[model samples]
Target: MSSLALHVADKRPEDPADLTGFYAGLLAVLNDAALNHHGWTGSVVADLGEIGGYVYMKIRPGEGDEPFATIEDLRAFRKRQAEEARRTEEASKQARLI
Candidate 1:
């Protein structure tokens, strides 16, 4: 896919950690939408380029393969995943013990 750059102008974060946190949080949103089949999507595209190199986000609420999501969506997906993980873990333990 062709990449596009974003120009944030004066809204850039000074601390590098801020960028890292943003990227991670955004990733979580996208991952949740992708794995949960929830009615949403989250996306972020970033590039380091002169003039326009920047980060962009697209939040969609539909059954589409777009990287875009909301905080509430991510939380719900994580909770469901955690519950499923526990169930799987318990099942494995039971099988091993049998």
Candidate 2:
């Protein structure tokens, strides 16, 4: 199951640094939610937007149908994919040499 977490900033800042700070604070709140929320295992998809002079963030558990993937999991998957691609390329080169 997936859950959506929403956060709204009281005021939108004109300065980029203030916007960054707002996002940072929002992420902290979302991280806390991820820690406390049941069925939320830290993997999330989040989006930020502004409307009516307010900044809003929406976060949800990533891909509800599948098991969540952590940063380590994604890194390992990327490594494996790269390795497989390298092996395939090497095999192609050997075949060409034949």
Lowest-lDDT window of 10 residues in candidate 2? 66-75
Model 2, range 1-98, lDDT digits (tens) per residue?
54565444556777877765665566667666665764565544344556898866555665545444343443454467678889999999999999
Residue 59 lDDT in candidate 1: 38
- Candidate 1 has a TM-score of 0.38
Task: Give the clashing pairs for model 2.
Answer: none
Error of 2 at 4 (Å): 4.5
Name the best candidate (by TM-score): 2
Looking at candidate 2, what is the lDDT of residue 34? 66
- Give lDDT tens digits, candidate 1, residues 2-24: 11321222233568778656645
**Candidate 2 global TM-score:** 0.49
- Model 2 lDDT vs. the true structure? 0.60
